[model samples]
Target: MLVILDLNDNNKLRIDMKKNKSSITLSSLCGIIIALSTSCSVMSKEYKTILIHGLQPQQLISASATNVEADGASYWSSYWGQVSDERIDWPSYERIEGKIATDWIWPKLKQFSEANLCDSGCVLVTHSTGDLVARYIIDNQANWLRNAGLQPLNIVATFDIAGAGGGSELADIAVSALTGAASWSFVIDQALTWWLGSDVTEAVGVLHDLKVNNARKISPVPDDRAPRLRFVADGDDFFGATKLFLKGSDDGVVASHSSCGASRVDSFGSCSRHIASDGQVGHQGNGVSGFMPNHYPMLMSDNYSHNSIRNAGHKGKVTVANYAANVGGKQVSFQTYDETTGHWFWKKQYRFVADSNRLSASELIYDAIP
Candidate 1:
């Protein structure tokens, strides 16, 4: 005989057994005990966190595929240390493009909810284009939750790495360079080759269409009520072009001119603000930087060139640390650590807490924890 427990609320199970009084024996009883123990082990499994990876060409190449469970726990468990389910590679961009609509993203959320993966709102950590995709899904889901009368999940925090939050200026430049009859620069051609793949002409054409048809229809985000937006650029980033791109006063390859938008709260008449990484962290360091004098690298690298900032994982870690340290507070903290010594060798903290009168408060917030 075999017994099974149904974990889902539907409360159903299937079992296979032979009913024979003469055949019942001590061996069968022992087997049942062993099976019950195994079932208990499965039911008791727990996860400390959930991590969703950024967009990639294929599922196998995605960050989630590398070390799914462990990566989630390391970067996204919680600020105060709590156990939670870690979801990875769910409804990835590769899956989205193949499906031709973003509808898949929501189903994964529903799946997580049904499975009790995110009891509290899950912390979302995304990179590059994946950041935008995730945001789109969340925004849509929030709308759905409101309509369905479901309690909104608590979004602890969002960690967007080198996100193309604002439109990419390099993308604009590439489209302009390709559309006109003007002579194409070798650098531009190489960039198209590297980033968009071999079919440079067609890729540029598609990008142009997307920008003109889709991007133009979207209104700019208002300044006062923009979403809880934060920027992590490389001082030397070339791909995103933080060095070549200039916001009103900042230089992120994507440009604050294009990236900064009205906060989501602004639409609701709520007060909010935008944040950015500190100085000495531009396109290459902690800002956005591209290689080949233009394109930004994906993560951290020692080269410290235009592309280096995006390539360094440490910068993304810094951004998350800053967000965690300042939750419910009006400050952002940043620090740099030594690999070998495992100590914070340098630190720069900022406390931008404002009072009811919109004045700076005396509360002190450190940039570096250590």
Candidate 2:
């Protein structure tokens, strides 16, 4: 006999069977296991979030040695920070190499599959050169998802901060300098040695090869049809100058010109229909303090520089606010607070409106995703 336990949560029920029953058949136990497993599976299969850090070679070391816990989000196991070995590829270099290597494919695929938090789908939170890696994963891992019995649903969201979505002008400058087109080979070499380590020559060569290969497949403009939540900060030093130097438009660190799609506003306009305006929030001034001030040259000088801007201490609030405004439902809610005051700014419970425009890059990512 099956005893039904009413789980307080509607649509969920638990079952209990008496242990003393000698007549309990194997088929009956199988039925009970199947029922419980199905319920647990449904519970486990919900919208999951993953954080993918970009281009730091050091992350690989940490992943291998540290008891890294989930930072409230699944972290792709990879070395993404500084490196002691010059021969090892950094995050940026590895991404390019991984794209070329057939074996690297399974690791990325498994990373996503094991983090099956997104029964409904998932959101990819990425930063800097990491956005390129995210794109590479999405483009190449479609087969992996199919094999794992998972479907790529709405991206749910994407947060790209100071992304080098378009190629870096600094990269161009380095190439010119090293190739004798520019007169700053000595200075360029010194800078590379100082930041990228003594192995600058090999790193640069690897970067160049990756860039060339990436150029063939990826476009500056992301597909409009893909449902995404995006954000861009204004004072982004890299895109801004890159816009002038490469594409001829300002994108904080990455030039909008180099970016594959329309200008920021234009891209927003096209995707605005999918973005929910009610979920929108905007910030004024440099997103963070303590960052160096030089705009154009910073991209080349500092490895951390980018064109994206985000509000200080307010990213979480903005994310919660935007998610609720654009894509609300029982599974979603909104929350906000002030950094300086430590005060609640906004809080609400709501469901997504189907007619709302999808969240844009300007809405969710800039200051928050990191």
Candidate 3:
């Protein structure tokens, strides 16, 4: 079992992450991009911590994947820890439903929730396999967090960056090889390790759970999710490398269709999964992205890729739109951008104006970049 890192129990991990923070930034200096709160004295409602899992680092000496909280604490702190308040954590890579996870492992999650989460709730910023672990806990641990004194805090913000909600082709191959379910000749046992690229380790990698059919089983989302759910996924990233295993568009590790959480489509162009955004004010409900029949879905785009979408708090490609509506006069305009190419189709956009207010509380936009 692997415990990643956090503020309370991970003092060592914190130090390690601080040391490597600059390296992570240098590695993805050009990474594409994409939070909140308020108060009079700016009192924090609850512990606003960032929780991350799934994509941890590999242990160099053991040829195994290191527990984020144990071995490569620096890697996580260096990367995601910088994304939010002050920290995150490590989780066991054991099969999520297995006793290893149920008995000794997942309790750590419950403990983490009880310790950090409060009225403000915590923001879940997940990526790739992190989505799978978070989905299970978010839907299943509602009562647990509530019992821990989290409150109607049942609702909270979730940011899925390059979410592998659908599943990954690499996982399919790994699962087949491990279980001997599919043709072993296609990818022998040793070859599967090669595909792993160094994940072979003492702990289970949770790849079986990431299989397509298995992953799709994670729907209908429970009704107890927050109103501000956001998913940022792309179809392509490592074109030169993904082609070897991925048959369709992928974000190096996840398929585009899977990453977007787009499960169903109709002849009429309507989709069961990718629900279009309901608009600004209409976002105060369970149905985020218009597809909340079961699971809390997200607004998606195909113009971007995975791996390169991690947020580092940079303003390189950010756009801020502020507005207030009262009688609301009329103004309308349109702009287009090809997200996949990372280029806007238009240089500028025009917005018509209506009547509004001044020194408003704040603004929250849930759109393509949400």
* lDDT per residue as tens, model 3, 330-361: 11121322222224753333221121111110
Clashes of each: 69, 48, 12
lDDT, model 3: 0.43
Name the TM-score of candidate 3: 0.56
**Residue-by-residue lDDT tens digits, candidate 2, 221-273:** 34322333333333333223233333333333344322222232121211122
Q: Candidate 1 local accuracy as lDDT?
A: 0.34
lDDT by residue (tens digit), candidate 1, 1-370? 6644333343223233554223232223434566454333323332223434432223223334544335434433322112224444433223333331234455565566556554533445444444454445554555555565554444544444444444454556556766674457766665544444444452222243223223323322211111233333334433442333233322333333222221211111001121233212212222222111111111121122222232322222222213323322333343333222123756434222122022111111111111
What Cα-based lDDT does every candidate model obtain?
0.34, 0.36, 0.43
Ten residues in a row with the worst lDDT in model 2? 292-301
For residue 207, model 2's alpha carbon misses the true position, in angstroms, by 2.5
